[model samples]
Target chain A: MPFGNLTYLVGLIVALLIYSAVGTVFRTLYLLLLSLGFLGYISPESLVILLLVSSLSYACYSGMRGQTNRSLWFFLGVAINLTGLFFFREFSIRESWSISSYSVEYALIAVGISFYSLQNLGVLIKEKLQPSAMTIPFTDFMLFSAFFPKIISGPLLRHENFLPQLSPDRNIDWVPGIQRILFGIVKKTVIADRLAYLVNHNFETVDPTGWNNLIVAHLFALQLYFDFSGYTDIALGSARLFGFKLTENFNFPLRATSITEFWRRWHISLTSWLRDFVYTPVAFGLRGSVLGILLAILITFALSGIWHGLALTFIIYACTHAAYLMGEFLLRDFRMKIKVVVGKSVFNLLGWFLTVNLVSISFLFFRSTSCIDALDRIGHVFSCSNFFPSNWKSGFIYKIAVGGDQQNIFNLSITLALTFTVLLAEKYVYRRLESNKIRVGLMVLFMVSIGLFGVFTDLDKFIYGQF
Target chain B: MDNLTQIEAVIRKVFKDDSLIIDAQTSADDIDGWDSLTHLQIITEIEKHFSVKFTLSELLDVNTVGDIDRIIQQKFA
Candidate 1:
């Protein structure tokens, strides 16, 4: 079940209560059962697959515990988990192979298989690398891999970072937990869903003009950020209640001055994971050669693209970023010299402008249905007829006028005000509210605002869950 | 020049900062242009200057100047 559902909230509360009453000795088993039940609620078939994958991973690790060919075991573990991920995600391939319909049906319902398999593979790799340091019990590994909050979409927990926090002696922290969940709800319902209306409308437009397409791209970027990061907040908050501290996923990514800095700040866990697992290894193998470095980046990002999906658009999106990063790498000396020529503030402003626009432009591919659609939209962005604002007044006013029923202008005004309120809250108010009473008040206020202004009809699913 | 001085010169030249003074505790955060890109450049320059190669793990594990110094010492010893 999606975290946004009322039933899921009820389930969460009931689970927490039961967890609080359970003894420390049974805590691991309790959490493991809770995670399994959570997955079962989504799909019994998925739950079985998860259990199988987890069991296979645990057995592989156990077999490799004292083995001399630990690396071989690690490769085997990775291959098994990756095969599971590939089978579930690529239904077309299964169909082509004439796989049994029952297995295909099972694959279709496998929701968190991608995320959990990666988590399991990470554990196996770590164990192989430092066997002595990663001696956790099988139950601990199960709990770590299948932890409900992070199993679906993740702050991609490393075993080293997550396992130590699973000790039975930890106490639940309620204040920050509730605060984060409430904040996530507000961000999702108020900001992301509200922006989704405009984004969906404009992106679906067959012949969007220059400013219109640009505005749509920017809104899509914002919508994506709020949607994914909002889910992350809920996940982190839920995990916190269970006394687990998942890694923070986003750190105000929109404010980054460069794409490189943006990666460091955005989807931080995945970026670091790819860096550690893919980029570093490739770069290391190609050390002391610029061509090797470039190839490593290309391979890493292509894999990142493939990880998202097998779509051509995702590949373009990843390639666009790789190009930008490589360009930055090649132009480091020039950038430094430019920084020396210009003042730091001006340099930063220039960097921010270029970085944000480049990122927004690249995301056109990510948001588009296909490469052809994205290219057509990009072409429209530069067409001579669309460059002027002559047609913008009527179009813009109509879009914000709520179906063009009345030109009262109140809807547009309210949208701008609400957008600013969400931005201000994210930037300032949310961080400054420290006292428990004040946090509770803000939570109530946020709930009331969401009730009043949230786009409840045709609610868009969290964007990153697909990946 | 010794390893430290030679490494310092390589860092300064790569970063285009002549006034750089790096000690054991110095890290990427202490310098303006010491990002991952420049980091590779610095490593490459060091390897070329010292005629020593670093493994991928060693490159990843080196976080601070002190780590670099130690690795270089071990390589040359």
Candidate 2:
């Protein structure tokens, strides 16, 4: 496949124009959506399936007018959405002759469905219970569901949060929006993309044998964090430009000393969603039982794991997290005791290092293709079996990067460093946004980032574009 | 009469907020520590101390310390 899916690109531009200047917002919105969906490689049946399920729910929501059983209907909506996803993925993958060889193929069009399904589901349910909240015109509701900024990936828009923002008649602060766009571009293009080289190199090879490989693994962890969170920053910043305040996805997760705390900070929105909608119910209903907590941990992580794809690697990834959380939960009292007793900087740093290493090991599941592959990779890494040892010399590093991956190690390092610095800088930017001076600083930073690196062409698509 | 002192003590004990004061009009909204997440933790501790289980609806509907105290009074009285 070529780099550009030109059909979707053309379709996206047309849809945007229509969205920006349409008569009846609902009808225009519908037509625009129809066009975007058509741009993708979906079959007639799947397209119909998508439209039918969505329309049915919206129609029910409109008709009920605060009269229907909200929870039951909402669950039904999720069921329908997940079922469609299952059928498309399960059936297509099983059948050797599936069309387009995209059993669970993703492109531009599928960007918002994962997040939008939840948004629309929440809206429909909220309609029956809190009708006054459903003030969005049908058109705006559709836009909110398929908002381009978050459609590909999400800060998982809550319906209650998104709908009202759509109706905002406030003046557009062009300056802030442009600044956010600049920050997003730097995170996505320059830094994250650069770090991606090292991350991908380390993950693609089975070697974890040498100290170099170990360092690579650590770098891989950093790279993954940068890439995903960088995407999220862009997603959020873009969402902000339109006056739609998406939830913060990352909260300086590298600072977290424990897996439990890391998840709470990283992908905070989705993890929180899984907690509120999945984990909490399971844990609470279990009533402090160890078995309950374990089961809840497993189930939540499993779903979280497979949310990436229907693959064994993801399954392992989930299990690793499940184990980490369970271990942390089990050792909570013991840890608090330990913390109180030691209460030292060295102990805290060691704890953080140990926790990060454990997390990196878990990423083996995410990076590898299968459980066996993941286990083998971990075995090699631990056993010091250097499958791809680095020379460590500047000359050799340059050669391996240039002659090897068609990318230079220096370029990768500089990019990753710049990206990391920007994110760290954003920590200051976030706080300083309250001040005029820092806001001006952010603009200068933004301009420098823009002049340095353009927006990622992949901006229209999220990393988790497939599932 | 197990007046405000007992209720206040329970609030202080449950939240580790010895400064918590309970009065007739005092509500969860007015207290800095009275988040809904921690609300049940307090209720559960109170139930352990006083020996009663609240109905689900009652648990969901609670807004004030006085409301909880009144409910406890009703059951015990």
Candidate with maximal lDDT: 1
DockQ of each: 0.45, 0.15
Encode model 2's per-residue lDDT on A1-467: one tens digit a residue: 11113444454346445544544434435543653465234344444554665666666565555455656665666676676555554334421211111233433223345566656665654454345543555566555555555655677877656665654353333445445555555665566555555555545555444454455556656656765676666556545544457777888887778787688688877786776566755655664346876887799989887666667777888888888877776675577567668885765786789888888877766765567867876776677345454455542354325334434655655665676676567687656542223367567766677567544544433344455
Please, what is the whole-model Cα lDDT of each candidate in the order they appear? 0.76, 0.60
Task: List residue ranges in candidate 2 displaced over 4 A.
Answer: A1-50, A60-75, A89-91, A94-110, A123-141, A208-210, A344-348, A384-409, A432-441, A450-461, B1-77
For all predictions in the order shown, the interface RMSD in Å is 2.2, 5.6
Candidate 1, position B1, lDDT: 72
Scored by DockQ, the top model is: 1
Model 1 whole-model lDDT (C-alpha atoms):
0.76
True contacts kept of each: 0.26, 0.00
Q: Give each model a TM-score.
A: 0.91, 0.75
